[model samples]
Target chain A: MATSEDGDFLPLTPVAFDILLSLLGGEAHGYAIMRSVQERTGAEASLHAGTLYRALARLVETGWIEELERAGSDESDERRRYYRVTGVGRRVARAEALRLENQLGAARAHGLLGRA
Target chain B: MSHRRRAVTERLYRALLLTYPEQFRERHGDEMTRLFLEKGVDARRRNGRAGAFVHWLSGATDALRNGVGERWNESRQSRREAGTPTANARRTNERGGGGMDSVLKDLKYASRTLLQNRGFSVVAIVTIALGIGANTAIFSVVRAVLLQPLPYEDPQELVLLWGELRNRGITHFPTSPPDFVDFRDRADALEDLAGVSTFQASLTGDGDPVQVDVGSVTPNLFSMLGIEPVLGRNFVEEDGLPNPQGALPGQPGVLPGIVILSHALWQQRYAAAPDVIGRSIEIGGGPAEIVGVMPPGFELLMPPTAALTPNVDLWTAARLDYVNSPRNNVVLRPVGRLREGATVEQLQAQVDLIAADLMIDNPIKATAGYRLRVENFAADVTAHVRPVLLALFGAVVFVLLIACANVSNLLLVRASGRDREFAVRAALGGTRSRLIRQMLIESGLLAAVGALLGIALASGGITLLLGFQPADLPRHRNRSHRWTRPSVHGRIRYRRGCDFRNGSRDPDVQVRTRRRIEGSGRPLHEPVPKADQERGRRCGGRVVARPADRVRLDGAELRGTEQRAAWIRFRRSPYVQRRPSVRPLPAGHRSSGFQS
Candidate 1:
């Protein structure tokens, strides 16, 4: 169950939404998440380094994501700080997806949105 | 890229990280630097040589933007959590906040706000800096060139004499040798007169052949100007005699007599040796002895028409035979000092009488349409350049005005968002004046930073401008450190002193000018002074407001132009007879000497 406080975090900003969706698949470092989001967005040539890091930091601070103790697969390299989404974050993502679906369904019924 | 280059790149990235908040830097600084290197490597491998450049450009911009954003958010979040307007500094003074402690807290808070809004602060500062930098640079030029007081004793008493043809629209032409003598003898209004002319001659017997600007001056010139040489003796009457080459350089006469070395030349060539006064150096193939060394920072400050640059390396007394000199061959540009209680108007009246006498006595003067005038030496030298400096100063002032408007607009935007903060302070017993004072503190902080940065930029810009060193820009190149406030004041005062002289004069001359204007069937022009334009306004005659350097109206396009008199420039020394290997100053180059 999504907490009311978690619902207050929605509807999500576009950058925050993209960042959460990318992190949900598995634990990943900043570069991997940046690459994944860039591939999905397909417009930005590459994700801005500052934008990716800032969003990741905010998500971790918000308790919607957790930074793992493991720095990277290469343990010697301290820079590859990795992160994963939390249970509350996953529930919130699902709730947002459902809400978007209901809005689209209403739009399609009203012919505001049409099937391609 | 080499390994060393990669190391430097990494270092630069680290330095850029300083813009981020300390907490953010501690948490992610290493990761970002590592990611940037890897990202750049990947980009270069995929996209060729330019790939690395693009990566650095985008990465730096991204870092700057996000660092500022994160800092803003940091401040915002802290304020939200604290749930109060006052910070640590203000809290210390919450009790009895009314004096020095209150002032200190206000300053601290103002600085804190600027630091928090890093992006807005940098943008505002840079905009103002650019405007002020440009203004300062232009001010440096105007200061050195047109606005500086002429460095001479009783400078106001000094006057420049010129012969003009009102009908021909030819003015400020140099005087002939005989004519100069005539003026000297006949003009009682003047205490004394001295002539100087510039020539490019070689120092042949020195270590190597070096080109130098030499001034041939009337021997008593120093005495008239109250200047004494720093070393050795001033030129005696004997040194004033024409060189052995008779009236001209190529004529059979003694080529060398005595020379005075400029202070800079003394230091450069002779190592400022005190015993070097009697040393003989061959000038233009003549054995010339150095009799004196001029004081440092002494150079002829004259108008471009006089063709005297401030850097003249050598001075020699002219030996002229006035009786035998041709009246039609005009060449000498003379400076005259008035007797005590004498005025330029008095000298002008005397000069006009002499010109009238010459027209009655000689056909050359009549045919040439001779008209004579005198100008305040300071006003005359700065005439052409003053307008240019004023325009540049005006332009930079406009730029500064626009910058101020932009900063005002930025402050308004920020203030609108800060209403709630102000409200909180007010509700907690802050008066309206206190809030205004706080706002003033913030603006004052911004101005201080902007002014400092602007001055730094100006110093660099002035150095760069000096490197280009346009020929007509006077007094500016040598004094690199002269960014003084007094120069600006001088500009304002100098403007008033010159304005009255430039106003309407001589209706007879104006009538001739009107006739000339009516005479020009086509739109042909020669250059006219800004003063002439002012005179033309009152005459109801057309004047080309901005004339090109290419002078077109010779004898007002009259048929008998040869009678207009040839201002023959004789290269007097046979050794100096050879044409300069380099080309003449390129077209559109502002010449300080008379140009046809």
Candidate 2:
């Protein structure tokens, strides 16, 4: 599922967790989101051209992401395609965060977080 | 599909199909491309041209990427399957240790190929030889004329100071002595200034008893050139003083003559004596003391105009009776080294100011001239010869171009014959790029052999030039014509009168010697005009080297032209008329028109 911050997480290649983490903020163009994801992760992750575009197409088709009508401006050289998270995308993102929080709490209860 | 449509479809299929690696291409490239095109065209009809382009592009890209990836993976897989122990060992060696092995192997193979194709190798070598030889010859001339440094310390600092006579509209002339003196005193940039003049001296006491070229110079001449005497010492300040009636200051009756010999003269005449200093020799009709010998290849700094031989077998400082000596005598050619941190332009500007001051003092000599300009010694000497050298280079380049065209045609023929071998190698996994590199290496090998032959040819050429050189060279730039031999004998023979060998016997010969006119300067032998000569006696000489019996003459005494011709007709005689072919002309020998 796609979310607002998923644009930022798009560049966190091959990692579903990092992608979800980055999409927590707002909508973005594909290239803009890829750059944001790379910057946030300190370049530790990079998305291949094929994989990134393919993932975007699949997300749009699944209705988790909605395409926005980008404003036509004099400065824009090409069709600046934009995307945003839909209602289903937001719901999926919240559920993912909750699932991760539960997993982390279990680890803390077992004392694994600070165990020597 | 019709044949045309099917052909078009196949073409489109082939474009996408060829993206596979060679290993895959041979096995299944055609089948895969056919399937992709069939599916792609149907998609294009439904989705549009842009859709079709994207679909085809993606298919081609994926195929290429996968094909290369599969090859790499398969090679790795085979290594594991075979459990090849040497694989890791070979990889370790290949990291650095075994690199030289491959280079040596390539070189050895190239050498073998060259050796096998002897005819092609020889022709290629000859072609390269001509190219390299022509280049070397032109470069040597260029080096002599341009590249080599002048024979002086910091030669770039040395400049020929010439006065431009602005009023007279003449550009360059030797600076007047007084002007040189004025500049030396006033100029702040000059480190040293000197002047030189040509004079002939009779080497009376020398073994050969001949005339030698002598240079009269100021005390600072050799110093300005940054040269030192190889023997004894250079001119001291005291040697420049003029003695009354050419008498030595200390030795009352004897003239105070001091002379410095050139290196070549010293070696030839003095046998390179160590104790050449303080030796007394008679020169210019006076006893002069040998002060020192100069280094070899030291030519006086002057433009070689009119083939004037360098009048400098020895050197002497100009005497100090200078107050009375007219500085207006524009004879001396001056050269000077500028001080460190001074450029030629700066020196010239400084000299110009000095020249202006002198112009005020002597309006006639100085008003006609502007500031002095400086020229480099090497450039001043070789500037005129540049055109001749360039012409020679152009001729040689034309020959080289012809040689290259011939070689290229030969190589193309050889390549056609070797096409079968190349095809076989290609089939056996050799790539096109590797084959081209091998052929280039073969060309390089041929070029190397040609270079060796070319060097030998160059040496022979230099020897030929040295052999028939004129007696007096360099001084006489037009010696080229005189240096040429008779077309038949290859021996240097001149017309009898201009021959220097007979300078003593014949006064006419002596006149020719003094003139030193080279290249067809001989006078034609003709009968003296009847009005110009008075008859004393009739002289007769035997006819030698007779021609065939075809005697014909014209005179007013004949009744008619045809009657005279009939009377003059003669039959072939049984006895062959012969005389001595070559003999010395007798002391009183004279020729007549009617020789019996």
Candidate 3:
């Protein structure tokens, strides 16, 4: 069940949703996230420095993602900050995915998905 | 593949990164730059220059779009977190705190009051307009001609060496070949010396006959100026030797009759063909081969009495031998570059000793009152106009201050009439600071509008001034068209970093563009313009060499036109303006004037 607090953020914008989706894979730096997101939805609509960092800032604010300390898995790890999705982020992503699924269901019932 | 060109691309990107707000830039700037460099190098390696060009074309847009977006968002976010602005005035209507909040309210209220007093507002704005407009016009000329540093290497170290006849009261007379040789050989403190004589001649053969200014220069003149030919080789020392009669073109000890084309003549006649180097041309109706082409905007500036025109269309080496030339035939106007840690005063002392020796040795010099005077090249060039410019600058400054004071007096008078409103607001619990702030905001609004109007008028005035650029005005060849902004922003930026009284920054809320290209990623060996070399030092490394690369890259300041156009687009961007706006005025309240 989506708590009322979490429900306020239900209909996440495409960029916020994509950022949360990219973080589903363990942890990554800014460039890595940009690369992964660009791979998913081509470089034509790119996540540049300003946009990527702003989305990251907003995500950190919403507790959807967290900045992490290097756990020393790679001993030579430099100042490249790594970020990962949080528990609340996972819940919000699940809620958003379900909402999208419901919309797809309605589309299917209305023969809008080329399945009629 | 030119790695230097690649480095220029990176340095430019780093300068562009200034568009982001400081905090956000601090968090991710280095990482972003590293990523950009890595991608740029990769793109270049994989697909060559065009691929890299395409990549950066998108990359530039991405950076500008996102950077401006982030800036707008940051301002809104900070305002929200800090407290209510005027939009939320009703929320804090009774409370007398919130610095920025109150300031905005005062601005809004002050604007309303000014609108109410139409006649007074018009009078005050017009007064300020005359003051600011005239000041701006003069400042443009002053900044262009006087303040603009001479386009050369270490211009301050460069000085004009002149022959002064103290007995006759002529200070800037030309020097003879023998005198020049003496100065050149004996003046150890002087780094290098070069002499030039200019004369008008008919240049024929390319298309039509045209009169051209020819500079008969010594061989060392090109090296002394530190300017290389944009194409072909500079004149060798042997080139200055006389071309004897019936001399073979390539025979040993025979001089080649050659001349270097000024950039203007080359473009005008030859259509800027690169292959014109070895082509035969006629100068002063005598056959000469074109050897080289000077860089665009290169000219020799000398004192007026030197009688050398600033624009020398053709440069031919002087064939007159310096060692054996006639002593009394004074023709060459000599200019010298100073060695490090040498001053004109120090040079004067040393030259006095040499002159005394010359007087003792040569009876002619003693009889003729031949003495030497060293002057800073720029100062000597502006000798006739410097005092006049200074006087004019002083007058404009006084006029502006008086206008400000006049407006200040008018404001006081207007404030006196608003006493009942002030009393009522005070009785209703308005703080003293609020009343004062309201009055301050009113005057500020009037001054701001006046300045804007003044900028418009000044631009018109500047066009007129530049149109008639008085014949005697020094450095009229300064190429001012490229540097002219002709707007209010131009003056404000001209004043920046000029406040010597305060070597410190304001402790108020910081603005965007705080870190202006103290490049963490300075592109090594990148080619920048001569104008940008001083600014390039701020980015670190000796990157201003490689004159072969004419690709000029001026940093963020040059982007004013695009930046402003993009600023309007960003301001209107829906994502940037998503936050609630300042509440709109009620139907009649906007024009109703402030009611007690």
All models: lDDT?
Answer: 0.69, 0.56, 0.69
Cα displacement (Å) at residue A7, model 1: 55
Measured by TM-score, how close is model 2 to the native structure? 0.48
Cα error, residue B517 of model 3, in Å, equals 58
Clash list (residue pairs), candidate 1: B241-B319, B242-B319, B244-B253, B244-B254, B245-B253, B249-B572, B304-B592, B305-B592
Superposed Cα RMSD, model 1: 26.7
TM-score of each: 0.53, 0.48, 0.57
**Candidate 2 residue-wise lDDT, B1-596, digit = tens:** 35686577567555544443465455345435444554456547767777666766665566656554555554455445643334533442345432443345445777776676676677767765665565454545455545566667888778777777787876567666666777777777788888777778688765778888888888788877778988889987788766676555345575557888899889888899978889887877777889999988677745664133474698878774555557677766777888898887888788877777777877786667665777766677666766666787677655554544444434533443343355444444344434454555455445555656655555554445536533422323222221111111111111110111111222243233334223223232343333212111111111221222211211112234444354334212322233334333322221211111
Off by over 4 Å in 3: A1-116, B1-106, B245-254, B360-362, B467-469, B477-596
Show model 1 residue runs off by greater than 4 Å: A1-116, B1-97, B165-172, B204-211, B242-256, B307-310, B467-469, B478-596
Tens-place lDDT per residue, model 1, A1-116, is 76676677678877778878998889888878877887898854466677778877888888888999965677565567888999988977877777678888988888886662
lDDT of 1 by residue, B321-393 (tens): 6677678777677889998999998889899899899899887678879977898988887787788779988
Residue ranges of candidate 2 with Cα displaced over 4 Å: A1-116, B1-122, B166-172, B206-208, B244-255, B306-308, B366-371, B390-413, B428-437, B462-596
DockQ of 3: 0.30
- The true-versus-predicted C-alpha distance at residue B529 of model 1, in Å, is 66
Q: Can you write out model 3's per-residue Cα lDDT over B1-596, one digit (the tens) per residue? A: 37897678768887778898888788878777767766666668878888788778877787888788888776567557644333443333444554564677678877777888787799888877877777777777787677877778888888887877787787877878877888888987899989999999887767788898899999888888888999888988878876665554445656545799999988988889999999877766567788999999888877667878878898988876666667778888887889999999888777788778877887888877878888988887787878777788788766665555455434533443343355445444454545545665676677778877877777777777778766767666553332243344335422221210110122210221122122222232244334343322321211221211111111123234464464345334442322223222222321234454
